[model samples]
Target chain A: MSSDPNSTSNAAAKPADGLNDVHTLSLVVRDRPGVLVRIALVFARRGYNIGSLAVSPGAAGGFARMTITSQGNPETLEQIIKQLAKLVDVVHVADHLEHPPLEAEIALVKVGVGEGSDRNQALHEVALEFNAVVVDRGKATSVLRLIGSRDELQAALSALAPFQVQELVRSGSVVMDKGRSVLTDLLQKS
Target chain B: MKASVDTGAQRLIRFLEHAGVEYIFGLSGGAAMPIFDALVDSRIKLILTRHEQGATHMADGYARATGKPGVVLVTSGPGATNTVTGLLTALMDSVPVLVLTGQTPTFNLGKDAFQEADVTGITYPVVKHSYLITSAQELPRVVKEAWHVLTTGRPGPVLVDLPKDVTQGPCDAPEPETIDIPGYRIPSLPDTEALDRAATALGQAKRPLLYVGHGAVISGAGEAIAALSDKLQAPVVNTLLGKGAVDETGPLHLGMLGMHGTAYANKAVVACDLIMSIGGRWDDRITGKVDAFCTDAVRLHVDIDAAEFDKTVTSHIQLLGDARRTVEALLPRVRPGDTGAWLAQCQAWREQFPLTFESPDDDHLRAQHVLSRLNALTEGKALMTTDVGQHQMWAAQFCLTRANRMWLSSGGAGTMGYGFPAAIGAQFARPDTPVWAIVGDGGYQMTLCELATACVHKLPVKVLIINNNYLGMVRQWQELFFENRLSGVDLEGNPDFVKLAEAYGAKALRISHPSEIDDVLSEAIAYADGPCVVEASVVKEDNVFPMIPAGAAVSEMLIERPTEKLEKPSGST
Candidate 1:
């Protein structure tokens, strides 16, 4: 972002020395043009690598919800969350690391024929292990939907990758913290 | 109640009226005709300027002087582009301004129609917030939101871009008055615990310094800051934008700290154990090398914006809140701390490397002398605006401002041509008050067309054009750091500034001899009619003294130009 190599730079300036933990942040923002770009830019400009991002319009309100995941040390991670909270479009940024929400993801894996023709049975076996269901099928392609936690979906996609995956569509992770505390409550307190 | 105004631009005018805007510094152009037409029937004054850049600077100046968000109106294309520099200037200085720009029609946006521009895209990085209004009904909401964004935490320039067709189109009625943006709530009240920690730290430190920044002035916490300074017996050092945050005549005041700062201020920064930075961004200029700047000190940063907190200078305690409120809360929690020995040490440093100027080379007017005389004539009663370069440093060093917010300059961006037009805005803000525009020859030429604006409005701002015949600051840098290459720094074909002012129907005077300094300045100050321009050809190569040479430590300061071989300061910040 800046050539600011100052040792006294903020916590975000720390290199990933022993950082192994990843954090997910949920944000409620105005459903306006360039809102996503502005939020994405904060992550991009500050050298924070975004592992995943998902934005969906709120069901009841005119606002939109954004869930972003990135890995950094707690020191650096807090700085990123603070920076995100500063954006005008961003209403609230709740770090899910503390609450450890019920995470879910939906992935669609399309497997092709030719090289992986013999592995069709193996792929079906892998899908069954992950509770995936075959949604579409043709002579050369098989589309399966894997609905589970982010890790389960990622493992299922990896299992099918070796079988010549024709295409992959992943719905990024979305999390809601432990029981009774809805996102609306978070918005209300803020 | 049925509204009298139905058109988009008329609705915008009605919104501004509700917002209590007094002036809209602007220029008329093809795309902005709707706004100009609406101005005819509104109570708000339209301060017409010769250039769009001048219009933005005037708005910035008005904001700084009045502590209210200044409003600007400009057409699309070049008029919108022209505001980039002024907007950057305001953004860097944290001046709140509502910039209204006309854009091409929605349908004409991507087709490159006449007077079209991607103004919103261009200013996204420099503005606090911006919008390209798609519909006329959204104008009121955008206006309300823009004002909310501009005047709130860490206020900067916000733009509400009105499409030409939208301004001309018919639309639904404006929304209800209570503009409660669900997404944008005012920041929570400041943390008292953090303030308590900061107060305790101040109470215990043996050597503490009140490092004031522009936030002190922006928050109008001059009295609170002064009270803290008094209670602690701590010396006060200000950044350039924070110049008038406290009375310059205070005994414990260290004028300014940074590249061209007083030796004592820089030395105090290095020696102090606790640096309480109030509302000031620790800009690159202030903290030469961040690690070395107040390296040993515990920084207590108080700012309204959390982004500014610990962004540059790492703070031991960050009190994120409005400047005025933060200071007010701290006033009662802390006791009168003692730093007498530290004050004495700082006094010793001040005496060791006093900010002084060499005697003028014969009859060439010394900038310092002229500034000193100006300071005395105004008696610290005038609103002073300075352009970037040597004259600005001279004013910052020599001028005595009696109160906070009395001085305005493009400090953070260091933009040239800000002073003259800014003076015009300051004059309008305080109609009967005296205002001075001290600008260098090169910077002055960039926006001298604004003299016409002052004349037409009869603003009565005193313009002090310090004609040094060169881009003085850059030339000074070239001399000290660039081996005196002196390429493209000269203003050889500069106009006769006095004649230029006279042609613009403004009173003009030229002073060359040293003897005429007092009389010419006195007459210019006494003039009660329209604006006046006083151009004095000054020493060309005179350098500002007590400079710390960019990245040098506070100890490595030089009061006078080195006569022997020069050695650059060691260690980058």
Candidate 2:
């Protein structure tokens, strides 16, 4: 998330990557009062800082899904999943990292396009190729909106910056596991 | 009673109102709309803000003003993310705030639903505590818990994330009960032995200094700090947060100590044989160089948070308890001491570095001149609000705070634009007190939108805008460090503040000359049926002096007033 070198730098520099006995669990629970609290309190009372959490309402009546990503070993993660499922409004709890899923965060990167269209056109073409939106445009900078994997967004940003770059804002990571039935099954359970 | 089957969201709002929350500042979106829907006809008034940042600062202002928990609500994802800055302000200032945010629906969980963000995870380090309400039935208990967490212990902001489904779900409101809070509870009194040890140390010292912080104000122990100082004949020094801990005009009061601290207060702290720290953690700003700070003194630290002990400075006697209770308990053991020479030394230091402005009295209106007039006008009844930078330090240095809880400003965070919202909060807290939000040109713009809230609320707060057309603090830095290569710091085009106030339906007064200061101040105070704005155009080059020069030790502060030299100028302007 942050360019704070402490966490990311350590992860990037280390070549030895054997999962680290860690797994990311993404759970979808019905968006209701205290549902997030119940899930979080369970983790908190057990002394766990959730790795990530993303939540939004579904297209149905009286149901929203909160995607909770937490770090633990297989056994602990399984226990948490089981406990989360037991929650009154929590419809489903699954580990999204290991399973097939759609994962990406939206980033609005403000890139400076030099003097004119040569740089702007090149960047605009690249954005079109990548299906990105130009949310903000100005003489000095254009905020190109990109929604994709962290790696992909970073790659695009690096490539787009042959011209001067101004500012960047990433809409933190949001993930949806593969298959249409996930939302349905969770809503039905609710 | 023809009652509706209320959802978890309604129950939460009901609990909030039951807890005596009159207002909730926030924005409504998908995950949290159910709560907003429930709030439509409720007793609690909701001020819909343009942005989450606005709500957070509004709540921040409300809390700083009222001495009660400020309440804010926002939708999940961007809504929750937007409030991070405000939460940090509350955390740093030790102001209690309750943030109610909507989370994405449970069914859409982890599937990366639209507008979903990890609120609790992101806010964990920043807040005192955070709660995510899962069950509709548990809404009452969760809200009650949040209020309790926000008010008790070292006060700070607490987050309650309510999912939309949970808000709409049908359930009976759960009764409030004491659930085991693992490690936190309102702490008991300090150990008798620790109290005795501290009292003994205080009794023997030749010169003792009592340092207080915002914790005193939060614990309702401002009187106790003053009492303890008087009882022991010890001079009082305050952290920026502890401005009104002792009446600014009272005897045995040196003044605020920190980076921009008075020279006397810093010297008193450094020269003291016994340093009794109450309600504050002797932070780096106060201590300067930790190793050398008060080397001759035996330190006594008392606070509710035990972790603060020995985290920075070594403490000979550490007491963990409420400031009021601890001071009360230690009173019987304390005996008066005489240190004429020590007092003389402290007064010498104070006279050496008096905070004086360099502005000529011939014409131009200076910020300090306004502060002086403000002090005289209010006669210490005014609740002074200060934004960060030259204006904030100036207000703290010059304002004669006579009443307890009269000075409100963000100290630990030193947030710019905080003065406006904080003044709004303080006015909300004490509606009768003459609240003034003193701000510089730069900081005034940060939460300028809150002026509308004050006008709407009909709060009779007087806004004193010290317009200098520059980020005066940053420009001051450029003058000293960058050799005056000022860029981006200059704010040339500013809105017509007087007209802006009129647009918001408030009385406006503009003062461009020194002659108009007294008249405008009196006029603003008298015309304050609702709210009023007084813009005083000050010189941009004016610099607040007797500075610690950033990384300098507390003892090494510039001992002479630079402004005095500017005023004298070695013979006439």
Candidate 3:
């Protein structure tokens, strides 16, 4: 359901620890049709579950950047990195985890405020505590939207226990490693 | 890019042109402005989309249309994140797409950076491979590697994350190399021992059922599969994905099996002594509850993916390699079995639950009639790309799929709006093949903008829009499930699709009368100068019968319109 390959695999096999052990990498490519299929086929063919992903284009016309998280030992990540480096559209690749970066995801969880005004208030209070928002409210249920780190959302979900969880949807994780130098430096002397 | 002077942006565009990339689809964003500026005078065409998801889907459409790797470019953060759904669609459907995203500065990597999303991590599982360029110098080599990974193996999405600084950084334009994957290659031949055991199994079986799946289609082994089916005197049952692997008109053909499959096909599979599955995984939809599936059959599973064999259905014999090669090797070894009893049982079931469509009396646009007319018009020379919906099922059922590699539909992904773009891809792959995109109203609107792509490329793909005024599949479900609650399925106001086609600079034709189908289709197909759209607005309430209401077993299917209803169908009566 979620496009995140690692999430599906992780859900199927809950690694006792978390996904931090996984290797993460990113790249820039020309944005074109079926690019995702090309990427997925590589991972699927090799039986690798991508942990997280975010993609966007560059300031110029033809290229875009894509970041991928994969759960594997160093050797597997090396193989993936090497493989990714070989695509014609790929312009660059890096290990963001090695660089240390800020990462987060947004999730919208719809819950049933069953049987009382207190249950509704409780759900709203939890959202407020997490700095979340109520994206939509309906007669039967209220949808609470949260944007935060996976840890934060998980904490928020745990806190909102009384209301029966109706549906859970999440935006794929996005990241940028922190530093002072802007990406535009290569094009212009800052 | 000049030999002596190559900006990071120019280097990226030049790399794309060298890789044979024809077009780029995405919106201009803050992080991507420098790259767009570089592409202003480049050979690679840039197409801006309404949204990032649309950009990816457009690229997916292009890939499906051209069989060339589709390319997408989006900015970091929101632009990057919006691509998940499109990436997911391509991933599920097996489209080769290359997605590129821009990031903030490398130094601003982890401090909750602005417009910063880890495109690689989020897409890791969804894509075949992904990368974040730590250094600008590595761009050229990485680009080459992305292509190799995309086209070589089972093609899917690949992503590359470019830090803004890195995209703009100067580096020697590295020479592109013919990248060789050390450990990734599609094996051509199965292990000799595995083939030997498979041949032995073929030699012994009294009644073998050739259960073909999408792998046969993927491996381009449909003809070989049919030949082997004949050599073994086996009835071939196809999964939904494997619809045209073996000709449906052939005597040995048993239609389809699994969810939405024929009753006789399911019975034949269940009752067979040996079921040799080529490229099928015995997915839950096809097998129902695995324990209760093909109980009597000794399954001979052949697949390129070794993990698929015996992963679900128990395999008596397994062949791991190309389906055509495996089947061809076993063809000489397999001897005809005295399957009179087995064939008779299969025939009996077929007679009991035969696939039929009533020839519509009122000149009303009938789905089956249109398909049959299209079949007659093309004479099995065309390729069919169907969007997943009621029309897809109808097209699969009614169309005469005699040629190998003629059927193209989203089997694994069941994606809508897939037909038009995918048809373009299929046509591009084999330019000689006349490709028809059979899409329903709802599905056509999903990726309708691909019309421009087709026109721009001068692809003369015929578009057959089966307009039923609703999301036919979901409506069918509502009719079956919620007793026609019809919530969220119906379209409130639909555009005149025929005129809409003309607006896109395409030839448009509409066939409302049953009698007009032949003439309209001929004229549409005859138009070779540009793309064409033929809207067949069928009678609104028509239901695709042989309906297996969701969760009901294959046997509990409605084979035909009820006797009372059929008998009372004449308006005069």
Candidate 4:
């Protein structure tokens, strides 16, 4: 299941409360073999439920950044952060619950309008309202690509539901700070 | 080429020799042939074990005994899989052990080649850090990094998986001048502000208690703990693994608190107003009911691992640093509280409920009696290691230890089959010291294969097997909590251990009566030419007392067996 977009909005969640509240943790780690497995094992060992995980090469060489959405007790999450920081390959771990980071997700949806111009025109207006672009068009089906916050993507999907949505695929949330500060800045000081 | 270059295996051996490693406990197999051959010309002696698990336990024992990183080298697949238990054992106790396992050639890594296994994937959860080496040039750096990670702050096990092709390939890489591990940091002195607060809490405390754990032993904080105890006029209690961190013979010391601990130690924990924990996590065994464990006490926790703070039980003051350094820093800042009445109350409890057992007027001997006699004979001078069981708890109660590292047991992991092999490792670490392995009948059978290793090396390790023909600890639980419905606790058709040890070329003796304990133990101890075995046939169903039932509060401890018999569930026999 995709992570709930509303969980990160509430910064005042108490420790050991709301076991199902999703948490977003960003980790900067060394680009070494088995680093991903090492990081994943830390979550699995603690029985924390990971909703979605994304990893990509870092801006600098010999490094990688990972975004993980998991749900567990906040107290246990604090211990999990400490355990992650203990890993030799893990450089930094930042939880986005306190200061919600700038996050976005992209989704592609294919809808069938049933060979009617009126329904096709209605789908186009719905796409326009949600700022989605038509990526492909067929006689009775059309594909639309949407990029926005998780809530926006949900609204767009619901708006297109009347047109017989055939398929949908989504890229998990990617995040960054609102300012110029980089996570790797901590690396230089250490 | 100007000259013949060294293979990766040869270079690894050379690096280990340069690192001052004296022994490598390993079992050789197909994929590990190159490394085994490379050791032919090296100064580090290799102790071949009967099983890979035995080899790992031996290395763990050596590390615990000497405070040096114990090294192990083994083959792929089963060899690598078997070391998982030993690695977890060391990891749970914060012991430093470096394991080197051979893998299939790089091309056959994920293809499921013969004798191939995903070494790093299999061991990631248990190890502190691991490496899967694909190229020969990475050996120097990996070896240095693994050693550094294993022996540094919050020491634990580290693994290096070397593919066969990588080790067989040629290498000429130079050793790095410095270890560049940026993410790995060793905590220095703790903040003075936290120390000041902890000292103030101690100053205000009327009934203070010093709770010692393995961290105190690891950081050599025993002298400081004693100084703090005397300065505050506070009584001291140790966790199971924390037994030898401070001298148990001292009057201020209450030996081993928690489940199966002394009643007086648990009583002191209940009465103390402030509890200062040094190097010991608030494990479930010690804090039986966390909410009720010293609820009124002001908690001060000092440890090197920051993750342990507020993990199970929240503390008011957290000092994150080496235990010795933090305690030493707090010494001058602390003001002694007036604890004369508190100390007298604890001493009265100690006198009222001292650790004792019934010397029954019968033919059968008791495990507690055997251990108490052993303690008297050794005079708390021997290095004692025990496997997990009722015998282990009895040994912890009766066999007093005098210094750090003097008593080693599988505390956190509760691993059976750990004692004999660990005794072999300890004997190697301290060749002149008296090494003893106090084991149960069940656990001794798990690692008795190592008897050959001890005999071959002529190591003077004494193995005392408390043979009661049952898995004593499990049977005790079934009898107490399960209406005496004994299921798989019986060990029927067991081989005679005396004959078994003799078959392995060890001097073996069997003693069944209490009167024979001193003579049999003296005979075994005097037989110093090689390893000796003494199988004491003890009472079959005796259980360890002063027990706090699992998940029960410390106040709910059963100081003795229930006087009434439990009613068995109705069934047709």
Candidate 5:
């Protein structure tokens, strides 16, 4: 008797600080057309808004690794993961925050250097403090790259806000458990 | 064995025979001619359905009626798309079906050739797994592995998309082997620690409810569930598909517990302090509002699918294993006690708010009354297949099936036109058992062409079309919620169903008066020779009660209208 799930629960419980309660999900899914859309539909159908999403070819061929950051109640997110795992195309799903997993995000900060101005030197200092690489040093701009946790990247971006930051791009956090096992080895052998 | 042919299609037939696929329901098309040729020599019987959707539903019916997997063969394009609803039905209900679809020639791959569909791509989300055959030699291994996946833990439909060229190539694939899919895992054994937790919960509760779902049927754990419930003396509420998991007539059984379920069943769900959900997902229909469903209950769910727990109602203890194994393991581990006061309260609710329908004063009969009388006559011994509508709900509420594998319907997809063909499949699967399809006027018209298939096969199955000249369920909804501005629900121009049945050469009967049900059913159903159809023109605007509207909590169930019986016509039955 389970029908259209748009109304899964009456008015999903959204905490006062729900927008800030970010959850990270890792998914291994079959690489096929509309696979991403299908996975997104699972989350969207559950009324969870995506904070950020990143997908890359997985370690195993013919599969993709998807990292999703969303803000919702842990209960609802757990339900969403269960729904996702129910999909045949989804190989494995994990909540990184529930376990000890390695998480990283890379960002590029191109600040307007103003042709050898003090801002360029200050940006260099900030890059050194945050272990960011000076990827490019053009006449009018200095593009610095930062690879760190979401919080660290946010702090670095805040630090570079003083300089005239021209353009900024960040890859959403990608996560995997910090252990000897992989999703395929764990899920397949379960 | 004599030297046999090595053609891919022939080898596939041999594999299906080896897997004990006795019946294959399908419709032939351009891409699958070789397999049809091979089937001429195969041992399996082919049930050529009037439509591909009916074929899939029939397979679904067969699989649900029997514990074994059902097999289906269809060609590509629309033949495959027509299967979507049926596949979704099986996938949602976790019934095992193997769908073999013949794809366009491999060389025509992405050219959108005649009757080509990306079957694998389209069905990825609905199937347990699907494979587009890339090698002719791998056909045997694919068949073996597909069987394993189809029948294993948390069983669901699996699709094997066969390219036509592969059917023409030589099948020199290695002999079948035991399933060794590295990524697939059977559910874990009954967790003793989890059982210990559940036992403690069950031991402490004063108001415990045993809620059985289709998982009990899937695991063949009806006896175990009944034994557990008997020992605890807890009231049992079945989900729609869980009707037969516990005999509906059992003293402790509180018939289905959801929308349009018995009032007592819905009341028990909200009032019970402890709810042990067995093999049920607590779907939105079951749990009207997830947060408020069993607000005060200490929840424990035993499901083969681990994904069920916390997905809807968060459980305190989750037994992640097969229902049979889990129930068997916990039978001795828990302390035996009865919910005396709690049981009394439930009994009070059951007694005070029993299911009832007013005796209309008109000559036209009430649909539910007919279903109830059928139950009385058959003693709930017949296997029932129902199409979705008011009739399906009435059947769920009235049909008193006494055992598992006797109630089959399109529970998940709620597909119309599913009952007649499914009745065909169920009768074929269980030749000795009486199979009756309880369908509505609107749904019956969708697949009435199948009456010929039934007559041709000479299967002794009875079909009761509850004729109200409208899509009763939708009409009821519109009447209640849409201020009676009924839109597309009317079917006043429906063909005379009895005449239609006679046209197909099946025994037919038409009953309009309330007094004719018993005689007509007894003569045509119990004593019928082959296929039979009974079209009963039921009272119009008759609504199914005990409904929990969408997005409402179970506690807020709309039991009955204030003037519902006041408007009943004069001739009381």
Candidate 6:
């Protein structure tokens, strides 16, 4: 652990190596009112900031699948997972720490294209390299939608940063096991 | 076939009756009128309290005493808000309480109508779970689910907010045959491999200590703990709420451990080679300076809540299950340790540093003396409840609780106004047993209005007030750590407690001198016609000793007042 108390950098602030590592947690929860607030409160109370979150109705009836990304000490994250599991609305909590699930995210990047031919050509080249498709093209701006892994999306955004990027929005990472087993299978067996 | 219809309020009351709820503690308000009216014809008795906070504490006390989920009913807005403290008290202590709060009509919920408040939102963090009923048809399912959630798997408080429109509306909904909470799971058995490891650790340790907590008391693990202690020849020290987990009078039992704990108990914690904590979280109060607490000991923690494992202090072996069941399972697999030397050392410490106070020549009563006398007079049989601060610690030191659920205090939240009302609740739960509320002058004034509730209900609870004209605990800290620079600790111009009790129609007594302690306590205990108040005017500036200053380790415990200036310990904010 770094003894420098003033260090705000994640690595120095954390007590142990990989303590500040970002983690994605998948939860299968009941489709009940206030379930989101309860789950969010669990993170908020522990001072763990959620980097991103995405939720949708689960394939299993009367349930919801939630994907939350947050960064904190792994010891504290273990406790957070246990606390989340204790919630009555939460069915299962899967921390993608050991298994390292297959993760993906989507981003819509709106860039200024009418600046010049050179800049526009450069943006198109970057989009092609990242396999991003032009979803909307306006007179001066073009919206490119990219679907890939989180790192790929980040690389694509960095590659397109020089073309006067106007606005960028990215969906939070969603994950699944890279095997035949399903996350919702436990619900059926229980 | 035609189904008969009833209003939501009627259905709620019927559900309570079906669940064998004997009492509901609450105050009436406009939004809850329908439910109150429905209660008029129900079998469950309603005990009206002066304040909603008192009602919640009463319910908490009742739950702690009876091991049944206590029920609370109050209106929306302020009524719901007032129960926050009591709910927090129950939540921190893991008491099972069900709070039913009235809400404004569903349409007016977000509009901020009269007597409106976001009750579920405000109480979200404190409750085990909560519900907001928008339709009368949902009452049956919500009530049953609420009870199930409140009573199972580490019991805690749950709230159900009812909108007035829903309660007044007609309902013909059928009760669910079985509760369908698939997400909730209760662990009944501990992992056998983990228990075997723990038993092995216990067998190898020459010096092992059982650090019990409220979980043991809640799980009724007294006999099992006693058995384990006897088999291993280990000494037992308990947390404040863990008072009755084992017989305090037993030869191997040490009193409460931590700040204001017995000196010998704290010493045992520091000296033990192996410590097994059962049903008790390693609270900051118990483990001062967590890194330094029991550092050399091999920790074995047993608790139903998995989140508590390695929460504050890491345990080498974590046994996840109910306290009683886990201990019973480990009994057959365990071999007794050779701890004769350790037992002798602990016993020697107990004799060398007994819990005692000096007798002043001025004849003014010492709070410690008064409490010891009360314990002797009651013969350790009375069900004792206490408010927070100096008197609370004194009571925990002197009062001998022999069985589980006999000692009830606000351990986690330490809410001051808890004692009198809790005693009332305990009286209601165990009508045959005598209940005593040991309170301080400052804490007694917080909820003294409950004197009316006790008088009206004719409860035979004895209220013993250790009247020192200051917030004794804070004042002690100010004098010791703050260079005697007093701030807001004084309680001057206080009303005469005897007169105040009389105004509330309660029998009152007073003891100003040391000679009057026995006579006054005897009179108050003998007066069983109604609630009685005995205010003992104790010496001011008296401090509780055997204290580990906040954030200081067990090594820093002070058995007496320091004659020189004191320095703040490290890691204390």
What DockQ score does model 1 reach against the true complex? 0.26
lDDT of 6 by residue, B1-573 (tens): 134568999999998998889999999999999999999999899999999999999999999999998999999999999999999999999999999999999989899899899999999999999999999999999999999898888989999999998898888889888988778999877888999999999999998999999999999999999999999999999999999989998999988899889999999999998899999998878988776788778888899988788777777788999999999999988899799999999999999999989974457689888899999999978999999999999999999889889999999998999998999999999999999999999999999999999999899999999999999988998898888899999999889999999999999999988888889899988888999999989999898988888888888888888778887655443
| Candidate 5 Cα errors over 4 Å, as ranges | A1-19, A26-41, A47-68, A84-92, A98-100, A107-146, A152-172, A176-190, B1-5, B176-178, B360-362, B526-528, B563-573
- Candidate 5 residue lDDT tens string, B350-400: 899989888754575999889999998887779999999899999899887
What is each predicted model's overall lDDT from 0 to 1? 0.83, 0.75, 0.73, 0.88, 0.83, 0.90
* Best-first order by DockQ: 6, 4, 1, 5, 3, 2
Least accurate 10 contiguous residues by lDDT in model 4 chain B: B564-573
Each model's DockQ?
0.26, 0.02, 0.02, 0.28, 0.20, 0.33
Deviation of model 4 at B217, angstroms: 1.0
DockQ of candidate 4 compared with the true complex: 0.28
Error of 5 at B5 (Å): 7.5
- Top of the candidates by lDDT: 6
Where in model 4 is the C-alpha error above 4 Å? A1-15, A180-184, A187-190, B1-3, B564-573
True contacts kept of 2: 0.00
Model 2: per-residue Cα lDDT at residue B499: 93
Model 6 lDDT at residue B137 = 90
Runs of candidate 2 with Cα error greater than 4 angstroms are: A1-190, B1-4, B560-573
Candidate 1 residue lDDT tens string, B1-573: 145447788888888888889999998888889989989999999988999999999999999999998999999999999999999999889999888999888988879899888898878778877888998878777777787788777879998889988898765665667765666655534787887888898998899999888988988878888888888888898888887888878998988988778888888888888888888888877877555677667778888777776566667888877777888888888886678889889989888878787665556788898998899889889999999998999899899776877999998888999999998888899887899999999899899988888888888899998888999877877788768889889999999989888899999998897888999999998897899999998888998877776666566666778665455444332
Q: lDDT by residue for model 3 over B155-197, one digit each (tens)?
A: 6798888888778777685666566333345557778787777
Give every collision pair in model 4: none
Please, what is the TM-score per model?
0.91, 0.73, 0.69, 0.95, 0.89, 0.97
- CAPRI-wise, candidate 3 is incorrect
